[model samples]
Target chain A: MSFINYSAKEINCKIVYYGPGLCGKTTNLQFIYKKTRPEAKGKMVTLATETERTLFFDFLPIALGDIKGFKVRFHLYTVPGQIFYDASRKLILKGVDGIIFVADSQVDRMDANMESFDNMKLNLDEQGYNLDNIPYVIQYNKRDLPNVVPVAELNKVLNVNGVPEFEAAAFDGTGVFETLKSVVKLVLIELKKGA
Target chain B: MPQSPFVMYDEEFKELTLIIEKLLREANSKCVYLVDKDGQLMSAVGETKDIDATSLASLTAGNIAATGGLAKVIGEKEFSILFHEGERDNIHISVVGQRVILVVIFDKRSSLGLVRLRVKKASEDLTKSIEKLLSRMQAGAAQENILKEITDDDIERLFH
Candidate 1:
């Protein structure tokens, strides 16, 4: 859920990056954290295992400038994509305003992608959120890999809602900002419609 | 939107801040803050200059959510209070009105008993104030849509 603080003239929204393990969800956030101006970003917090796999989640709060004088900030979070962490994933989705489904585009990971996508829908449903109504976009990450599936095929399975989808190589920063911007725009537009 | 977005106005913000500030003083704590269940930092008081309030807020909520999940598995509705002790400092976290998390940070200058007592009183007042604010938001929902006044061009301006 978004938090609108009139006292601070700020609007804070939560956006989660979700996918199967090793889909570059954390990499997307790290790239954004590294590139954002110091003044515009907060410390990136990663709750990860000793080997650096996300244990609970990764959080990065970034200010996306002002809209009609109210400073707009987006708190980007990535859930632990490993399947056994479904409980943790549900907790992270408790009050999400938007979502970015980071799908690994590898041909061999198709089943993993489908399974994660279904898991996301189930989690959101349990929390009273319907995937169709929420503001969300899909990111086909790891596009640099040679064994990746075609965007058209990935969309056929993951983008049933026909939400905006981006082909991204998050480690190299390709389409990272574009994906973020698209989702943010969709979130704002949804907010306006709600208002 | 199954759940309404959380909104804070100037009046309620001031009231909440005052209550937190009073709790900070009464508990002899180093910091006190309120975070929504979603991890948005609502208001904070005390030695926050060196602290990363945003990260703290996010983690605190995560802690509560994880605990709450555990509660459900064991067939409990929720765990209303959580406390953590460190070598030099401690944290006392409680849920207020089932929506907000009240956090108190302290050190040797304070005792958990005192912090808990003060937090008990403060939580009551905070819960009442939060109920009022939620109602106000519902009433004001029809007043004006801020984003409606903004144009697509205005949104495009943010990126540039």
Candidate 2:
């Protein structure tokens, strides 16, 4: 859900990065955090386990300038992509404004990617958010890996709705901003449409 | 969107901030703030400069959500209140109107019992105010055209 605070002259929205474990969801956020100017970003909070895996979620709030004088702030969150964390994933999606599915592009991780995609749908359904209607984008992440699957094949399997998709090597920051910008654009358009 | 629309106009914002200020004073807490379940900090009052309100808001929401999930699996509807005791400071969190959270941060100046008592009363007041605000937003009285002034060009320029 987007919160429009006229008093503060700010528009706040939540965007979740959903994918399987090791899909670079957190890396995408880390890159954005590093690139954003100090005045434009807040403290990036990561709730991770002892092994550095995300335990709950990663949160980063960035100010995307202003739209018609209202400060447009997007809160970026990445749910713990481990399978057993389904409950945590569902909770994160409670009021999501947009989603970026960061699919690990390694060829051998096909099953893990597909499983996470299906799980995302189920969790969205449980939260009464239809995957088709929500503003969504896909990032085929880790594209620099040697054994990555072809983008066409990943799209054929995961992009059933044909949402805007990008190929990214998040660690190197390739296509990271592109993916974030695309999703943010889509979200703003949706808000303009009053959806 | 399954979640109801959220908008805070001047009147509603004033009422909510007033409530927080009163809660902070009554509870003798260092600060009082409100965050939506999504982790967006709505309003805050009292001595907040020493605290990272944004990080606190995000972490608190995540904590509450995790606890709420635990509540569901245990066959409980929801866990209404959560308290954390720190070395010098403590936090008291309560779910308000099922949409927003009321959080109070205190120190040696206040007791847990006093904070809880004041929070209970403040929660009731906040619930009513938030419900009214929600209804107004739903009715399209105050939030009908929040983005009416925003243009495609304005949105496009952000990326450039």
Candidate 3:
């Protein structure tokens, strides 16, 4: 739910980053945190396991430029990508206005990506959000890695719905903002329809 | 303009916050706080300083809102208790009368069941106060006599 603060005249929306473990879910957020203008982004906190895998979640409040007269603030969150953290992931998906599905582009990690996508769908269904219609985007990350799945093959399996697909090297900051922009824009459009 | 912000509640409702405080203490829990559906902190108790109550309040409400949405999807109304287990401890977040969020954080020392019971009572209490507050807010009485309530120094301090 977006809050329309009459006092501040700003609209705040929550956007979540979700995907399989090590699919660069946290990296996508980290990249944004690093690249955003210091004035535009709030503090970013990432709590991970001993191996540095995301444990609970990473939260970053990013203020995108004002669209029309309303200040657009997106609270970005990333759930732990590990499979055992399914419960935690479901909890994090709560009240999400938009989503970016980061699919690991590794050829060997195809199964994890598929399982995570399934988990995402199941969780969304339980939360009354339908990916088929909700504001969503997709990114095939690790494009720079060798033995990475070709875009077409990845799309054949992952892009069944054909949401905006991006080839991202999230660590180097490739296609990160494009993915973010597309999702935010789609969410704004959805909000506009309601208005 | 009530005696106590919580005094408007009858005796049963009046004991709500105390009950939550006592329960947390007994369970050796870290902290407990009540937040509105929009994540505004209504009241807090225990060691919540290190914890970002603002974010916690917002996220807890978000958790509640999502559970409510899930309820609608499956032909249910809304979940009363949502117990999420962390690696060491756990977070017990629930909706109270569909108006407020009651959150309790505890480690292995505290049980989820106890937290749930106390929150149930607190929810009843909070709902009444919240409803009354909302009606009062809508009446626009809160906006009246604004200039008389504060001194010039207070206004000046706001600028500095």
Candidate 4:
């Protein structure tokens, strides 16, 4: 349940990034942190382990301009991607307004990507958010890798409903903002429909 | 309907606000306020006038929500405090019984320990009030009717 503060005139929405470990969920946020003008963003908080695994989540509050005079802010969060952290991932899905599924494009990580996608659907379903309906987007990160899966095959297996997908090299800022923009744009459209 | 929708007669909410004010005063702080977990500004006291109390209330609630989310991920119960230390000024925030967040923004003349003690009492009071609010809400559509009872003028007040 989102808190609508009529007194503040700011509608804050929570959007979670769900994907497999090392699939660049955290890197996507780090890239956005570096790319966004400082004025447009707040402090980026991340809880990670020594080996760079996300321990809890990364939070970045981005101000996406005003709509009809209300300052619209989106709280972007990334769930810990490791399979062992499934419980943590489930907790982060509570009250989620939007989701971005980051798929690792490496051909060898195919099974892992599929597992994470299935996990995303299960977790979201448990949260009462339909994967097919909620404002959802997909990002195939690490496109720069030599062993990356072909976009066509990635689309065939992962893009079940033809959700907008992007080939991204998160470390290089590739397709990062495109993914964020599309999901956010969809969020606004949902807001317009009052859903 | 009870006397006032925005006003609380339950001694708990009132006393909670007073405790908050006392804490801020003792800290030589600027102001203080309590926001429910859902971001409702329960009671505010201080130079909240002319300032962005509404946004502060909502953001503080957001902070609590974020922290609560983190605690759950870590297998903890919940977070009750979030402190943002700054140069010359700082924001001392604490969550009360997971129901309301107590905030105190102070400058040079105070200690964090003192703020914590006062907030504990206020938190207890605020928690009781929220318990009542939740129970009242669970009582049924009466709460929705209460909102329905709001006049056009009140709705206008919300926008303006």
Candidate 5:
């Protein structure tokens, strides 16, 4: 849920980056954190294991300038993508305003991608949100890798709803801002409709 | 929309800040924070110059959410209160009105008993204000429609 603080003239929205294990979910966040100007971003928090895998989540708060006098801030979060962390994933999706499903495009990870996608829908339903209605987008990550599934096939499997999808490497920052911008736009449009 | 955005006006903000500031003083706490369940920091007071309020608010909500999940597994409705004691400071986290998280960070100067007592009284007042704020937001949401004034051009400009 977005938090509109009239007193502070600010609007805060939560956006979650979700996908299967090692699909570059945390990498996307790290790239964004590295590139965002110091003034525009807050400290990035990572709760990970000893091997640097995300155990809980990663959070980054960034100010996307102002819109019509209200300073718009988007809090970006990445869920622990490993399947065993389903409970943590559900917790992260509680009040999500928008979502970016970062799917690994490698041929071997297709099953993981499909499983995570289904899990997302189920968890979202449990939280009283339908995936179709929410402001959601998808990122086909690891495009730079060899043995990657074709973009057309990935779309055929995952983009049945055709909710704006991007092909990203995430490691070198390809398509990161584009995906972020697209989802934020959708979220703002949705927010306007409700208002 | 699944749920309306959490909105707070100036009046409610000041009222809440007053209650939190008072709690900070009475409880002898180093700091107090009012965070939305969605992890937005609504208001904070006391010594927070060096603290990362945003991260703290997010983690506090995560902690509460995880605990609430645990409560569910045990057939409980929710775990409303959470306390974390560090070597130097202790944090007292509680749910207020089931909508927001109330957090108090204190050190050796304050006792848990005193913080709990003050928090109980303050929670009552805070809950009342929160209820009023929610209703007001609901009533004004349609009429305000502030974002409706924003155009595609406005959104496009943000990317540049």
Candidate 6:
């Protein structure tokens, strides 16, 4: 759920980046954190295991300028992509305003991507949110990898809803902002409709 | 989707800050803050310069949600309280009114027992305050559109 504090003149929304293990979900967040100006971003917190794998989630709060007179802040989070972390994944999606499914485009990781996508749908359903209605975008990440699957094939499996999709090499920051902007725009549109 | 949008007015914010401040003093805690279950910082009090309130709020909410999931797997209704003991500081989180969380961070000056005691009483008051706030918002929601202040043009400019 979005928190709109009239007294504070702030609009806070949560967005989650989800995909399979090693799908560069956290890299997308790191890219955003690095590119964001210090004045516009808060401390980036990563709750991860000793191995650097996300144990719980990675959270970054960013100020996306202003809308009207209110400061629009977006809290970006990435769920632990490992299959064993399903419980943690569900928790992070508790009040998500928008989602970015960072699908691994590598030919070998296709199954992992599909499994994670299904899990996302199931978790959203359990939380009483239908993926069809929520504002979301897809990022076929790892595009620079030589073994990557074709965009057409990835889209056939993951983009059934035909939501906005982008090809990204998150580590290099390619398509990162494009994917972020697309999802944020969709979220703002949703907020306008709700208003 | 399960809950309505969390909206806090000036009066309610004042009341909440006061309560948190009192709790901080009474518990001898370094800081006390209120965070929505959705991870938004509502109100905070005490020394927080060394603390990153925004990040803490989000992580605390994640911690609570994870614990709640654990509670479900164990066949429990909910785990209302969570405590994390560190080498120096400790954090005590409790669910208030089922929507917001009251977190108290303390150092060696206080004990968990004392923090919990203060939190128990503070949670009750906070719960009532939040309930009142929500009811007032609901009552006036029909008459006033909080989003009315935001226009289509304003939103359009955001993307550009």
For candidate 5, write residues A4-102 as lDDT tens digits: 988889999999999999999999999999999999999999999999999999999999999989999999999999989999999999989999999
Clashing pairs in model 3, backbone N/Cα/C closer than 3 A: A21-A81
Task: For all candidates in order, state the fraction of native interface contacts they contain.
Answer: 0.79, 0.71, 0.00, 0.00, 0.76, 0.68
Query: What TM-score goes with each of the models?
Result: 0.98, 0.97, 0.65, 0.68, 0.98, 0.94
Poorest lDDT segment (10 consecutive residues) of candidate 3 chain A: A1-10
lDDT of 4 by residue, A1-195 (tens): 333333455556668899998899999999999987888787787778998789877878777765445566777889998899887787677667778999999888899999999998898877677787778899999989898889999999999899888889999999998898878766555544432
In model 6, how large is the Cα lDDT of residue A188? Answer: 76
Candidate 1, position B21, lDDT: 97
Candidate 5 DockQ vs. native: 0.79
Indicate the residue-level lDDT of A75 in model 4: 75
- Please give, for residues B16-119, the per-residue lDDT of candidate 1 as tens digits: 99999999999999999999999999999999998899999999999999999999999999999999999999999999998899999999999999999999
Model 6 alpha-carbon drift over 4 Å, by segment = B1-3, B140-146
A40-147, model 1: which lDDT tens digit per residue?
Answer: 999999999999999999999999999888999999999999999999999999889899999999999999999999999999999999998999999999999999
* Model 1: DockQ vs. true structure: 0.76
Which lDDT tens digits does candidate 3 get at residues B6-72?
A: 1112232334457568757866788887765654455677888788765776667656766776787
Tens-place lDDT per residue, model 5, B30-131, is 999999998999999999998999999999999999999999999999999999999999999999999999999999999999999999999999999999
Alpha carbon deviation, residue A188, candidate 3 (Å): 0.8
Highest DockQ: give the candidate number. Answer: 5
Candidate 3 lDDT at A40 equals 78
The C-alpha lDDT values of all candidates are: 0.93, 0.91, 0.72, 0.72, 0.94, 0.90
Q: How close is candidate 5 to the true structure, as a TM-score?
A: 0.98
Candidate 3 local lDDT, residue A82: 89
Runs of candidate 2 with Cα error greater than 4 angstroms are B1-4, B142-144
